[model samples]
Target: MEPSYILHTKLKELVGVHCNLAAPLHFLGIPFYRFAENTLQEICIKRGLDQKKLLLHLQESQKQTVVPSYQSLSKSSVDVVINHLKSTHMWFIRYRLPFISQMIQDIDSQLFNSPEIAEDMKIIFPEFMEEFIHHIYEEEDTLFEYIRKLYKAKQEGFMNSTELFYLMKRNSIKVYAQQHQDDDDEMAGIRYLTNHYQLPAHASPYMKVIYSELKKFEEELMLHSCIENEILFPKAKALEKAVVLKLTQASKLN
Candidate 1:
């Protein structure tokens, strides 16, 4: 859609035609239930978002065919990788998970007459969500924190032998990467439960939206894991090695 047309179109009309816009709009903090009547321009103005950038994101969401490459990011500094990972973590926690949970609840309320699917979702999704959130917390609190310290050590050199020894004793990036399992099994359970997300012949529009969004979420999760395992961990391990090498040289000099 043209930028001018998108700016002028009612969000309801736009989203009706492009249901894929729903998650991106939610990520941009535009709740469709509340702002469907507004034009994109109006929402942008009210939300203080750049209309051009918002339009571009929406358009890209529609047209994007491949997962974005993280090859360049693999060469980026540990701080850059950490920041990108943290932003993805925030998006999952603050936007995607809640939106999916709410959608499940909506489906449950509407599907009480035929509650099997909804009941399965209610039982399964929350368990997956809880584990996912805990994983995020552990990364931020332990793994990311350790990486940051390695970065600091590289930048400042170790303050003392004890500081260096303490960091060396901590779990290394290699260990974390080895222990990290992608969401393949968890998402497989969801896909299996939803019967490969094949919509029933009589599935409602809302049901279709939930299934579509869940599939997208699964893709995003896979990409997130790839970035962490392939890019973040390698860079961090290199950083750790550099810090250790510098400390070793200093000790030899002493």
Candidate 2:
């Protein structure tokens, strides 16, 4: 059977409403290392009947270009970003993995009778476990490290948002509007993954419930990423550059 357009529409809406880049990459249908590239490949492969169809379908998804918001704040303030990160990314790491781990056990128990489902579950389960370890590292090594550096820099009165933006811009960092894969796009890939290229059937109450829950969580993660990547980050970059300019001028006067 063909994929449900309704689910796809609802999932797309979720991405439009909820995604934040501050969220963990894994929760956003990406792992930290090679997330963008690998995830794109994974989703496309998972959903498509074969490699060629997957690639072609992925190529057609819309791309977002962030336009900075006018709201002023410190570039490195970390408040909004942290809030988003905690709610979307950290929460998943801290909580969802354990629940999913339990679910995997349940799937394991059922595997003997349902070999195909069991095998698919096994494939993704171990991959996700390994991915989780890397997720932790990204938080500690990359995301948190950056946050700490930003905090220290802020404390030392080094620069504000505007200044930071300009500095990164001058350095050709390309920090803003980084053209992240959209959350809906990623979630579609995930639906492809979790459902194993097929929709949950009206077969049993158990299958239906599990399928529903997974879809819900996947949708939530995707939406969260969309908000951050498409809306929040662009605005943050602009604010950073603007504030940084003000700070630089103040320094010059001293």
Candidate 3:
């Protein structure tokens, strides 16, 4: 749909034309089902979101043909990258995870003939979900919080001697980046259990939806890891070095 048409189109109509719009709508904090009766412009106004930018995001989300890139975001400020990452986490936690969990619960075990697959779904997937949530918490509380501190230190030029000393002795972004590993293996067990999400020929619709969403979730996880490890981490390391250098020069002057 053209941007002009989409702006005026009711969300339900737009979603009918592009079913994939549902995910991006949810990600943008727009509940399509609740606002199905409203036009995109109305929803934007109600939500106080910039309509043009929201339209651009929706259009980009519809490009199923291309792999979305965060390369440009690497050039963004540390807070900008961190904020985007936090939003991604919110989407995962608030929408995607719950959606998948409910679908998993709704699956008819009898359809799976294989007890092993059922057991894996009941046990392994839930465990993985718990671990994944914990990982997000750890990053937010530890890694991301530390990065914010580094950014502040850089921005303020390490003026506070006590704060500078505290930061210098605290966990450095360089150290964290060196130790950080992309959790590609986090979903490895589940992927192996599901045979890479290959559903049986006789798989029911519910089972199909589960596998499809799971595959998409795994892909999103890989992209999230790439952004953190490749983009955010490198820039953070540079920021840390700059702050430390400023502190050293200040010490020399003192």
Candidate 4:
């Protein structure tokens, strides 16, 4: 959020995962730091980006000022964000996780190189997958569906608004957001087992391919969490709060 950081640091160096923001970053004409010294709200106002939307985004930046590379994703409609999230869920659960889980099955005890790798591969990877799958289920079955409906009700806020909003009120975004558990331990084990994903000289081709695929998976996973934590959850929570307040006020009027 500071002028020194924005002007000095490369955009990708700060938050580029799978997303590319180079072209758009360059779009903010000369005098880039004209309002960088101001609050994020003021900077957005000065730069012509939506202030309210960016505020929700910065909240999910691991509490950092370095605006995420997928800031454009934050400005997308709720339904667009939800669809992207669901598709990512499918990619992880149906494809990526299963593929990685199977690949680890043949971790050669003989050529595993490091004893640390051998032990963690057997113990840690399996544990991480089990917990990872569980986390995905919580979102797919409960949270994603709720968010879809919540966004829908927020959009079509009339005929059955009171009832729909009341149902949302009972369930509450706080409940769902609170369920957003930390997944660092799972990825941490992967990093540890792979020796920071650096393939060894004597490693087989299969091991190299597997490690490469895993790096892709890790990048995808980071982008996935960013959308939910930064964009979807905050917008959904705000909408839910507004709906509840409206319902309370209407009840008082009666």
Candidate 5:
């Protein structure tokens, strides 16, 4: 909305939550992307209505929903970061991945006509999903637990452990990251089969569900990846560096 346009952060704080309101706001004939640069009043004027009405709607709708607050996680504690990753891993494995695979299969098998296209579409979706799930499990079993241990050791006191032992177990963050194997290149297969997941104009309910769920899965994953690769990884590395430095200093004094 322009002169009165609110930044999303301000809107989130004013409205008391963080979320993606692009779809609903767009339906109101508001230019969703304008949200990046314009404020709410700018949008209201375009709709030829008072900005107050627009604000009211956004506030009312936004008030009820509670979403994850990533802002707080910018410099969050290790346990909080690990818990977020674990929660994200569980969601992908237990819900999002399975739901998308099933929806794609059900829609392709029942509604689509071409056998070759259907089979290709069916295979690619789950292949992409399963590979990503395996990657998540590896991190859960190894990297996340390693960070948790390091954090615990830091809290307990670096001097608590023997110098020889701590140095032996010590690793650069780069080494841990080198173990983070993620290749989503195969996911291009799903996109190719779905023609970039574009639905036909007269798409049925199931077709709509398939596209919508797939889109949500990607969005959730990008957010998940951002936390893991950006916020959590850097912070963990800093934490590790600080701990190692403390231990190294202690050893020199000894």
Candidate 6:
């Protein structure tokens, strides 16, 4: 089914038909849930990437520089940044990975062709899959874990060593950015799937569903990463820095 039609059908099931564009854009722009569809639409057009394709492509292409310290984060914006990372990056890792992993198995069982293509898929797709999962796992285990620790430290009214925190923060940012780039690469793999798999004239429902979901996932992921790299992360880092300065001053007074 055409993507728009599928989205429309899904929306109709949720609420009686209306002119509202919210639902379609909502799933497609998960972390930046506040953005208007029209705005996002403009961005997609400007980039010459369809909303779906753009989302998938960017998410597949993540490569971020790490910031070593929370000292830079403004106290006020830290919460917002944390929430965004947790919801978009952390939560997505938890939920989406299992679903994608399952789909991979399903695809393996059904989607196959000449031995040559199969071998090619093995080489290309496995690394793509590895990077995608590794990105998620790393964030969950290391990045998010550190964020939690920092938040806890913030709450307890104590600060860690400035230089050490800076070093770690920078590394974390690098790790996170790399993970994001990994996602973009993963989406590229999805594109490869769509192009390479010569679906039988009548693909089975399992095949159809798997590909459809993969397409949607990839598109949204690209949009999400664009927002993060271009708009969100810089703002977050600035906010963190501001917050850290204030905290430093407050401590000095005591």
Lowest-lDDT window of 10 residues in candidate 1? Answer: 106-115
Q: Residue by residue across 172-236, what tens digits does model 4's lDDT show? A: 67777666644443587688668788977766434554566678788878777777778888888
Q: Write the per-residue lDDT of candidate 6 for residues 1-254, one digit (tens) a residue.
A: 24454233433231222212322333444222122233444445555646677445434433342532334333335455556555666445555544545434434443333334444544565577677667666656765555555555555635555643574456555456566665555566657656744455655433444445456567657755665565445554443464466567766877
What are the runs in model 6 whose C-alpha is more than 4 Å off? 1-77, 87-95, 106-127, 140-157, 160-183, 196-201, 243-254
Ranking of predictions according to TM-score:
1, 3, 5, 4, 2, 6
Winner by lDDT between candidate 2 and candidate 1: 1
Global lDDT scores for all candidate models = 0.78, 0.45, 0.76, 0.60, 0.62, 0.49
Pairs of residues at least 3 apart in sequence or in different chains that clash in candidate 1 = none
Better of 1 and 6 by lDDT: 1
Model 5 spans with C-alpha error above 4 angstroms: 1-65, 108-110, 113-116, 158-171, 178-186
Task: State candidate 2's TM-score.
Answer: 0.50
lDDT of 5 by residue, 1-254 (tens): 33243432433232222223443454465523234345555444555777666667766654544645788878679789889779878867875676556546655454544446667767776777777778778878778877777787778764464753554376556776655524433356666777777877755444455556566777777677777777877888988887778777877998
Off by over 4 Å in 4: 1-71, 158-166
Top-scoring candidate (TM-score): 1
Model 5 TM-score relative to the real fold: 0.65
Candidate 2 per-residue C-alpha lDDT over 81-138 given as tens digits, one digit per residue, 9 for 90 to 100: 5455555666566656554544445543342334576567656765665665465455
> What ordering of candidates by lDDT runs from best to worst?
1, 3, 5, 4, 6, 2
As a whole number from 0 to 100, the lDDT of residue 59 in candidate 4 is: 38
State in Å the error of residue 64, model 4.
29
What TM-score does candidate 4 get on C-alpha atoms? 0.62
lDDT of 6 at 121: 46
lDDT of 1 at 126: 90
